[model samples]
Target: MFPLLRVFLSDLRRHPVGTLLPGVALAVGLACVVSSVLVGGAYDTAIQRNKPHTPAGSAVVIRAPGTDLPASLVTEVQQLTGVATAQPRQVTSGQVLGADGRPLNTPASIRVEPSDPRLSTTTILQGRLPRGDQEVAIDEVDAQRKHPLGSSVLIADYRTGKPVKALIVGVSAQDLGRPGGIAMVAAPAFATAHLDSTTIYGMDVVLTAGTPVDAMLPRIEATVGGNYQVETAAQARASEQPSPIGISSTLFVMFSLLAMATAVLVAGAAFRAVTASRVRRTALLRALGASRPPLVVVTVLEAVVIGVVAAGLAVGSGWFISVGMLSVLNSVGVSALLGSTGVTPAVPGLVLATVAVALGVAAAVTAALRPAIQASGVPPVAALSAVPDAPVERGAGVARLVLGAGIVLLAGLLAMLGIAARSFFPLLASAVFTMIGLFGVLGPLVVPLLVRVPGWIAGLVARFLGPAGAVIRVAAREPSRTPRRAAAVAMPLAGAFSLLAFGVVGSASLRDAVVRHSDAANTAAFDTATLLGWGLLGLSVLAAVSGVVATTAVSITERRRELALSRALGVTRTGVGLQVVAEAMLLSVVTAVTGSLIGYLYGVAIVSMLNLPTAVGPPLPLLASLAAVTVLAVLAAAGPAIRGALLTPTNALADN
Candidate 1:
C-alpha cells in the first residue's frame, strides 16, 4: 500500500496538469449545481419571510363580488368567534400621472396600504410608508425609474380622469400579486382619488393561533355564501404568487442537471484521452505483474483525489456565483418585482459540501470506469506497440446502426403523436429522443457528415489564402478522422445552444401573448426571463470552454507524432497553432447552427401548441451567444496549441 501510494504521489507530481485536466469540467458542474440550490433556497426563504400576514394571526381569505357581499355580511363575519380582525381588500386603482401632468404610458394600479403592519406584504426600502390623504408610496422599481422618494406625483382618477397630487413618501418592494409598477395609498387617500374606493373585492380574515383552519372553512364557506370562495393563508399566497417561484425553481433544477450531464460527457472524453496516453505505461506495469484490478484501483484513486480538489474549489466559487446571480436579478428589478427588497444569498453549509464532494466523486468514478477497464484489458504486447486503436468490430457497428435507427424511429413516432394531439409534451419527448439517438448512439456515423459543412467552407477559404489556409483546411478535416472525439465535443455545445435558443424564442412568444391580451407589456416577466436566459448563457459558455480545453489538450497529446512529421515537412509552428484554433472554431459553428435550429423549431411548436400569437423574431441574445462561444472556444484552444507547436520535431519523434 505504501509503495503504491508513493508511486501515485510521484505520478501526480510529475504530470499534475495532465492528471487534473478532466476535473475542470467536474468543478464547473458542481459549482453550477451548488449555485442553483443556494439561489433557489434563498429566494424561497425570502418569499416565505415577506409573505403577507395579519395582526389577528393565521388567516383565511374570503372572496366575492361586491354585489354578493353586502355591508351586513362583512359586519357579521368580523363579529364571529376565533376571528381577530377582518380587512377588506380592494384595488382602488388609478393611472399614474407623469411629471408633465399627463398619465404615464405604462399601465398602473393603486391599492390602499394595509393599516395593520402585520398585513403589509411590502418592505419599505426608503423613507416611511404612505401616511395620510396627501402622501403615497410606489414600488422601489417605479421609484427608481420615475418617482423618487419625497417627489410630488399625481394619481389620475379612473372614473373622472382628474389628477390628484400626492407626495411620495416611500419606495416599497413591489407586491407579489402585482406584475408591474404600483402605487400604495392610505384608504382615505384612495377614496379622495377614486369615488369607487369602497368597492370590496375580497376580505382577509385573521384567525386566532391554534385554531384549526380546516374546521373553520366549512362555517366560513356557509357564511360567505355558495358562490363565494374561501381559502387558508398558504393557499391564498400560492394563488397570488403564481409562476415566479415555480418557473425559477424549475429552470434552476433543469439547468443544474444539464450542466452535470455535460460534465459527465466531458469527463468521459477526457478520461479516454488520459488512459490512451498511458497505454505504454500500463503495459509496463502489467509486465511487472500488476493485476488488472490493481491498475483500475490506481485510476480510481486518482479520480478520488481529483474529485476532492474539484469539490472544494467548486463550493467556494459557487458561493460567489450565487451571490452574483442575486445581484444581477436585483439590478434588473426581479427581486423588487417579486416583492423582495433584496434576497440574502443562502450560505452553503457542511452538509452541502459533503453532498457536493460525494456527487463529484461519484461522477468522476462513473466517467472513468469504462476507460479504465479498457486500458486494463489491453494486452501488454498490444499496448506497448505505437499503433492506433482498433476500429469498431463489424458486429458492434451493425448493432449500433440498428439501435440508432430504432431510436430515431421512436423520435419520429413521438413527433407524429405530438402533431395528432397538438401537445407540447410529445414534441419535447421527440426532441430529447432525437438528440439521444443522433448524438449519444450514432455519434461516430453522424458527426463525420455533420462536420463536412464546416470543412467544405474551410476548403473554399483555403483556395484563396496560402499556408495558413492550408493549415485550417487540414484542421477542419482532422475531426472527420476522429469522429468520436469530435462528437463528444459537439454534443454539449449543441445541448447548451438548444436551451439558449428555446429560452429566447419562448420568452418572446410569452411576452407577445401578454401584450396582445393586456394591452400592456409584461416587463416583470420579460426581465425575469432575461435573468434566466443570461444564467443559461453563462453555464453554456462555461461548458463550451471546458469542453474545448479537454478535447484540444487530448488532441495535442494524441497527435504529437503526426505534428512532428508536419514540422519536419516544413510546416511552420505558427501554421500549426492556427490549425488548432481553426478546428475549435469549426466545431463550435457546426454545433451552434444545428442546436439553434432544433431549439427554434421546438420553441415554435410549443408556442403553437399553447395557442399563443406567433411573434417569433430574431433572438439577439442567441446570436450574441453564438459569437461569444466561438470566440471563447478559440481562446481555450490557443494556449495548448501554442505549447504543442513549440515541441521540437526531433524531441517529439525521438521520445515516441
Candidate 2:
C-alpha cells in the first residue's frame, strides 16, 4: 500500500497538468470558504466601528423613531443599579446655514444635547461644548473650511428642511463615518428654537467598571419596554444579524456550500474520467494478483494527497484573495459594513482554513467514491479483456429519467406548498435543493438533448475546415456514445450559466423592486449582494470551466488511438484541432443555452414566488454569460487540442 501510494504520488508529479488542474480546483473551492469567513469577520468589526452606539464603552443605547424619549426616561435609566450614566440626544438630519443666512454647502445631523463629558461620543478640540440654544458643535471633517468656530450656522429641520441659526461653539474631531456636520446643542435651546423637532433617537451610556452588559440587557429591555429600540456593545458586535448581510446570510452560505458541492461533483467527475482512462492498467494489476481493497485504498489515498496539498495552498491563497475582495468592497462604497481595519488574518481565519481543509478532503473523497466502488467491483477477467461496462439498459435510462422528473416534481410541490403556506423558507429550501439536483443530476440529462442541434451547424463548420468538419459532425451526432462522460463535463457548465443567470436576472428584479419601494440605502445594499453574487458566480464558473476542461481533456486523451489512426489515414492536424474545438463548443454551448433557460426561469420563479412587486426578464447578462462561457470553453480546449494534434501516430497507439 505504501509503495503503491508513493507510485501514485510519482505519477502525479510526472503528469503535473492533471494533478495541478484538480488541485487548483480544490484550492479554489476552499478559498471561497476562507475568503467569505475573512470578509464576514472583517465586516463584523467594521459594522461595530461604523455604527457604534457606545463608543465610550456604554452598556446600553435606547432610541425611538418618530418619538422623543422624555428626559424622565434618561433619569430612570441613570438610576438603575448597573447603569452608570444615560445621556439622551435629539437626532435629526438637515442642512446648516452659514452666518449670511444661506444654507451651508454641506448637510449635517442634529444631535441636540447639553454638555455631558461622560456619555458624549465627541471630543471638543477647541472652544467648549454647546452651553446655549444658539450654540452648536460640528465635526471638523464636514466643516472642511466652512462653518469655522464662532461662525453662525443654521441647523435645518430634517422634516421641513429648514435651517435655524446657531453658533459653531465647538469643533469636534472628524468622524469618518459621519462625513456631514454633527451639530451638538443645548437641549433647552434646541426645543425652544425648533418647534417641529420631536425624535430623541439615541442614548449613549457607559456602565460602571466590571459590569456585565449581556446580563443587564434584559432589565434594560424590560425597563425600556416596546417604545424604544435597544442596543448594547455586545449587540453592536453582532449587529450583522439585522444588516443586509445578516438577512441574506443563509443565501450567502447556501451559495458557498453549493460551490463546495459543485467542487465535489466536479472532482468526482474528473477523477472518474481519469480512472476510466486507466482501466486497462488497473485491470493488468488485477490480473497480476493485486487485491481490490489495496487498489481502492491507493486511489482514495491519491485524492487525499491532492486535497491536503491543495487545501494547504488554499489557506494562503484565500487570505490574499480576501484582501483583494476587501479592497474591491471599499472601492464600491460599502466600507460601512464590509470594511476591515487591516488585512491581517485573525483567529476565525484559522477556523475557516480548517474548514476549507475538511471540505477539500470531503470533495475529493466524494469524487473518488463511485470510481473506487466501480473499479474495485470490476471482474479481473473482464477488465483484462478490456470489455466495457455492460451497455446501460433502456429501463435504467428510463428509471433515471423518471427519478430526475420526480425530483423536479418534489421541488415544485415544495415550492407550491411554500406559496400556499406563505412561507418563504420552504421555497428557499426548494431552490437550494432544486439547484443541487439541477447541477448534479439533471444538468447532464438536459445537456444530451441540447447538443443534438449541432449536426446542422456542423455542415456550416465543415466548409471552413474541410475533413475536420466531419469529425465534429460525428461528435454532434454521437454525443451520447459516452453519455456519462459528457454529462460530467456538462454539469458544471450548466450550473455556472444557471448561477450567472440567476444573479444577473434576479438582481434586475430586485433593482426594480428597490427603486419602487425601498430607500436608496436599501437599493445600494442590494447592489452589494448582486455584486457579491456575480463575483462568486465568476469564480464558480472558472472552477466549473476547469472541470469541463479536465473531463474533456481526459476524453481527448483516451481517444489518442482513434485520433492517431485518423492521422495515419491522412487527417491533418487542423482537422483534429477542429474536432477538439467542436467538442468543447458542444459542451459549452449546450450547457449555456440549457442552463440559461433554467436560471432565467429560476430567477423569475423566485421573484414571483417571493411575492416581490417586480418583474424579471432575460437580461443581457444571460446572453453575456452564455457568450463568455462559449469563449472560455473554446480557450480551455485549445491546450488539449494542441497536445492532441502534436501526438505521434505510432507512439499514441502503442502508449496507454
Over 301-335, each residue of candidate 2 has an lDDT whose tens digit, in order, gives 87887788778887887778878877886666454
lDDT for 68 (candidate 2): 68
Model 1: lDDT of residue 332? 71
**TM-score, structure 1 vs. true:** 0.84
lDDT at residue 30 of model 2 (Cα atoms)? 71
Superposition TM-score, candidate 2 onto the true structure? 0.76
Q: Return the lDDT, model 2, position 485.
A: 59
lDDT of 2 at 612: 72
Predictions in order: lDDT: 0.74, 0.66
List per-candidate RMSD values in Å.
4.6, 6.2
lDDT of 1 by residue, 162-261 (tens): 8878888877656555444564545445565553545566777887777788888887888877878788877876665635445456667677878888
Every model's TM-score: 0.84, 0.76
**TM-score winner:** 1
